[model samples]
Target: MSDLHELRIERHIAAPVDVVWRAWVDHQAEWFCPRPWRASVEVSELRPGGRSVVVMHGPAGEEMRHEGVYLEVVTGERIVSTDAFTAGWRPAGPFLVRIDEFAADGAGTRYAAVARHWTAEARDQHAAMGFEAGWGAAADQLEEVVRRLVAGG
Candidate 1:
């Protein structure tokens, strides 16, 4: 991960690693995007070269579809996907590689999400798009989702 081309949002979540891992992948739609922007996973194959499409719906009927392929998926640990390719390894407009990691921390978990861009300009583009605030708020929502999951909701 290059400091000049990566944006990250990490947090210490008060939940077990498995719970956080589920929220990060299995129940992604619940907290994938910030509020006012809901997400729906169209496909989640969870394997190397598997397709993963998450469509984010804006409050005003706008839709931002993120279509990509999983480069790697480690059960209960991490997910690495990239928009540089869609399903079947076909090329697409390159954006970033998205990495979500969960590690056991005492009785809780440490979660980190990174957006690795191809260039400094792309990194700056994401930062200009309120990456910190948006991703940070989404992280908070993720924690809430984990809590709800633990409560058997």
Candidate 2:
């Protein structure tokens, strides 16, 4: 009955929210994405109403930016934003709204990210485009960082 459908992936990191947040929003972006062909996440603004950009730098020195505006931001808790295919939120193509939530637990920190699609077709398209695999790979990288930092590495 809902117009939107969501897909999510979560990981429990062995670090506090701040540490995990930094890793997630900062360092990991440089090495995130499922494949080497994709660009690394470039810029991020961690405040409400701020803007973020992810630039995919090509081997041939070409650049592509994925820009978005933050819809909501709660320090150490959540971030909701919409991303466009091009730079500066100009939207070279369709856009996706994402919700990222974080919580502190005995396991350390619980981090979850959800992508909402306007239709089933969009969702299916994303799946075909490697949504799970890409996000999953990124999460795996984050997990390694969180564990290392928490363990005093």
* Tens-digit lDDT track of model 2 for 1-153: 246777789988778899888777667554456446455655666776677777776667777777877778888899888874333445545547898889998858888988898778888888888888888887787777777777777
Per-prediction TM-score: 0.95, 0.80
Residue 26 displacement in candidate 1 (angstroms)? 1.9
lDDT of each: 0.90, 0.75
**Among all candidates shown, the one with the greatest lDDT:** 1
Q: How high is the lDDT of residue 114 in model 2? A: 87
RMSD over all Cα atoms, model 2: 3.1
Residue ranges of candidate 2 with Cα displaced over 4 Å: 1-3, 35-42, 58-63, 84-93
Which 10-residue window in model 2 sums to the lowest lDDT? 84-93
lDDT of 1 at 80: 94
Once fitted onto the true fold, the runs of candidate 1 whose alpha carbons sit more than 4 angstroms away are 1-4
Candidate 2: count of backbone clashes, pairs at least 3 residues apart or interchain: 1
